[model samples]
Target: MAREVFDLSFSNGFARTLHERALGDIEQDYPWQSLEPSRYPPLLLARARVGWTENAFNEFCTAAAMGQMLQALVQARAPLDLIGMASRFAIDEVLHIELCARMAMRLGGGAPIHYDPEDIVFALDPSLTPLERSNELVVRLCCVGEALSFPLLSGAMRSASHPLSRSILETIVRDEAHHGKFGFLYLDWIRAELRPAERDRLGKAARQTLDAYRSLWERGPSHVVAGVTSEGFLLEHVRELGWMEASAYAELARVTIEESVRAPLARAGIML
Candidate 1:
């Protein structure tokens, strides 16, 4: 992000309500008793320094994406239930920020987060209606991003050797399931409002999003396995941490994209 970023203190009443209600039943969870951060070798420690920083960055982006969705919801003149969902999703992202940030601390801390609020939300795309614009972003962020996140996180949880890491990953997987559904719900509710051309645009966008996320797995710094595992200190480091093998990790991402993202999107008429 450039410079501007969100400030919850200044949020509108509706946004505030969503935050309060969603967090009302929630309590922070940390596996303090299970943590053994010091036992991790240098590679996993580097994973901590670099990996946690990347996690924090993604969380920051998630928060901004949610903020954008909230604005789009209001502009789209959505019904109450969907609006409430949008509000709740915003809160979810904020909590995730806290969770990820602390996880980084547990991993031995990471780079400081910096973001521009302007960069957080989507800029208005003049070619589409308010509703269509909202749908497009939801398709990318919630539909593709959050939807795929579930399986990816679940795989990570399964691969995690540490109890505390599993706990944290589990919590994230739990939260992300709902977020993944939020896109489908929003799209379902507003299908009638969308033009055929708009749906095509969304379909195209969804495909692009799939490709983008797949690229991350195949090539993105954090998810890519080949970069570190091709033969070097990083490879030895990863093995010592008992982290999932790169082949396994990359395969998990690929399968999730094909089945979880592509198939479900086809069912939703957002064919990718």
Candidate 2:
């Protein structure tokens, strides 16, 4: 399939009800009107909008990945509770997608982002056993991705001066607390079935996933617009608008990978 521009295609009537049901009373209102996108530099707003759009796309991918996990769990005859949790996780990711896209819109509308629908979700190897397949997906999505996301988002939340940005990050980090733990839960449930060789393979797969994540941080400097480095005022605006400086962001990513990701996986017997 050809790539298409990303769109939420949201509806206020039915969607509002669905959002309430999925998020319950915890879903609070954001003061979207208070956001002054014009206060920031146009280039800065442009960069932020693009980042938010990317975030929305990533959330879409995560929701799809969670759906795949839910199906795999059902096929593997995983515990009923685990399957139910996976279903809930998918709903959470979908909510995140809307939040991210709306954040982009608040920043002066979402930037153009084209994505291949079929290629958005990660593709697992068909040759793996049913149990192994579930393990790989959990490790890739939850263990590494969600685990690293928690601390990074927490840092972002702390750094966020804007109320809307802080609220969104806080909500995401709250849900991610469960998401980050899901892999170990799944692993514990299936530990008896995994052999030494299978564990080794999972470790290797996890390492590759970590490498991909690290690469994103390594590309951080490229995202910085021209001349922002020499302008202290512009840098402060970036921080106030809820973005970490490039060096700090990269350093945090490294620490998060070690403390939040690698250590947890090692404890789960899936060392990377």
Candidate 3:
């Protein structure tokens, strides 16, 4: 019955292949060299110093959340291959926290991570089913979180004046690409399994998440440590990258979520 409850191990090969590819991809996509350091504020070194601390705290929160999600997936009897790959991802995220901390230190400040653990880990809707939970996790954490990070980190890399900062952003970008790929693959897999109604539900869910992500990016606390607000400048740059036009940005957000989540859900016959 029910396809004999497919063994978690059955997905191991796929997970391993994807994991190894992730490593290779990161190595190949290093972005430090392409970044120019001349765009940052010259006088706000102090703010930069504080910003890095805030960044490190935020990264720590991210890593903790990822770790919890991975643990949940494993406990839910997810494919061993997927679990294994996620295990590695958990480790990678932990390292990311450490790396961000070091970067903050290099920038000359240490902002303590003050977020409530509940706020970071159980931030999702409690009413969702396991499948919905999984969908939400992949969309929020992988697609929106990591996807948005790509452009943000790229801008940061380009604006970094210090060598360490440049290297840190480069390393992060490489790892994040792999993390984003996980969302892509999982969405693909789920799409093939969902019904039409489920697919529609997913589409609505995805749109809501994207809107939330946009709001977070636009209004979230800034990292400007030197008493200078970089929000206007940062938003200006993002606009230059085509993220300012409501229609265009919405399309990009939809495309990104669809490519990583919806298409896969569709393939699986999931509604929305």
The lDDT ranking, best first, is 2, 1, 3
Q: What is the C-alpha RMSD of each candidate to the true structure, in Å?
A: 5.3, 3.1, 11.2
Clash totals, every prediction: 4, 0, 27
TM-score of each: 0.78, 0.90, 0.62
| Candidates arranged by TM-score, highest first | 2, 1, 3
Model 1 CA deviation exceeding 4 Å by range: 1-28, 112-117, 219-243
* lDDT tens readout by residue for model 1, 1-272: 36643222326689767765765523344565456567656665766656656665677778778888888888988888888877877666666665666666666766555566566555656877778778888898888999898888777777776656666677777888988888888878877777677778888888877776665468433443554655343553453333556667778888888888888777777677
Per-residue lDDT tens digits for candidate 2, residues 21-122, read 866644357766667888987778888999889889998998998888888888888899988887889888877887888889889888887888888777
Residue 59 CA displacement from its true place in model 2, Å: 0.5
- TM-score of structure candidate 2: 0.90
**Predicted candidate 2, C-alpha RMSD:** 3.1
* Best of the candidates, TM-score: 2
lDDT of 3 by residue, 160-182 (tens): 54455567676777777777677
Candidate 2 wrong stretches, greater than 4 Å:
11-16, 24-28, 216-233
